[model samples]
Target: MTHWPDRPICAFDLETTDRDPRIARIVTASVVVLDGDTVASRTWLLDPGIEIPEETSAIHGVTTERARAEGLEYTAGYAQIREALCEAWVRDHIVVAFNASYDLTVIDAEGRRLGLPGLATGLVFDPYVVDREMDRGREGGRTLQAVCAAYGVTLTAAHQAEADALAAGQLARALCTRFPQLADLDIMTDQAAWHAERQRNFAEYLSGLGRDASDVDPQWPIRGIA
Candidate 1:
């Protein structure tokens, strides 16, 4: 059987105005397509239509002033980002993200906010969920940076959309290389099941600690629309 990373793949990442996907506005986004030895990528910087909070700017290095001057208008940039991903899907590329739920949800919410067509759910490979399933007993964080390090992949610019997107593609390839069994499973179905199970386990762990676990959603790739 052909392994996933051995085939064409598209990796995506986003930097946004807030942590909550339901309310967040996209500030930057990237899509990286890898096929054999060729790589193609597109990146977008958007005005987001609101002042980016200082803390969020600190994380992504896109200040309000900079975004206003250099970024594309939100609608134009967002449309392009959506089109890129859709094109990759049409070409049968495996779409990858580090934590797909958040990025995909950001796209979903933004599409609704702008009255644009939503990105249909497609074959998605999330390294965050895969790493948890593959190495459930490993210690330490599963941040993209940490996972990249663990897999000997270099993430040169941690929060930059293009860098993160490219690194996610590399990390997915590395993961599949390490665990060939992953290629035998159906990405959409198996990943969804794994993510749901993991979310349930984490929710139980939180409940045992007497914390509110009500917000723990098991939805994979995208969360419920708000």
Candidate 2:
């Protein structure tokens, strides 16, 4: 059997309406399933049950009209996305998202709202979280682009969901190699625990930012490139 480090994994990314996974609809999603170090990829464009705002279209370039015309229906798209997430989990692949909390929570909430079950993917790797844990004493905290810069990983085609997924995967792999200790930590975190840790980190983080704040925690954890 392959080692955990070499195990099957899913590197995923989503482009959404907003940063809050609860309110944001997944406009597009991509999953790259990796066996060992080799990967096979899948991507979907979705009609998110709401009009795509002009600003969002400017970011990801998928207009509401275009999505409605060519993209899969919201229900069908969610079903397909859920199937991929569940399958990836059952196969023992880590559901890798650069910041997993927002995506997983969004998925869980969306499935429930749609009368479907939660993602069978029991675990997730937030490269951002993992990077923060590993590089706690380091400067320039763990944004995907910044982490990629620190690790010398190049990000191509910024704002494109599929490209962002691949780039995050590259950073995830590099981080694992650079800090093997993290792979040994318990990555099977529940939403509440993940949420708690993020809140704690942000509060501490904002103290560093010199911002006057009652609390630095935003209700949402997925910062950018949702």
- Candidate with best TM-score: 1
Cα-based lDDT for every prediction: 0.90, 0.74
TM-score of each: 0.95, 0.83
Q: Write the per-residue lDDT of candidate 1 for residues 69-185, one digit (tens) a residue.
A: 999999999989888888887787889999999999999989988887666966788999999889888888899999998999999999999999999999889999899888778
Instruction: Mark the regions of model 2 whose C-alpha exceeds 4 Å error after superposition.
Output: 189-195, 201-226
Models, CA RMSD each: 1.5, 4.2
Give each model's clash number.
Answer: 0, 1
How many pairs in model 2 have backbone atoms within 3 A of each other, for residues 3 or more apart or on separate chains, i.e. clashes? 1
Q: Which residue pairs of candidate 2 clash?
A: 14-226
lDDT of 2 by residue, 108-205 (tens): 76877787765445567667777776677888856777888898888887778777788777777888899877666655543335556767776777
Which segments of model 1 are wrong by more than 4 Å? 1-4
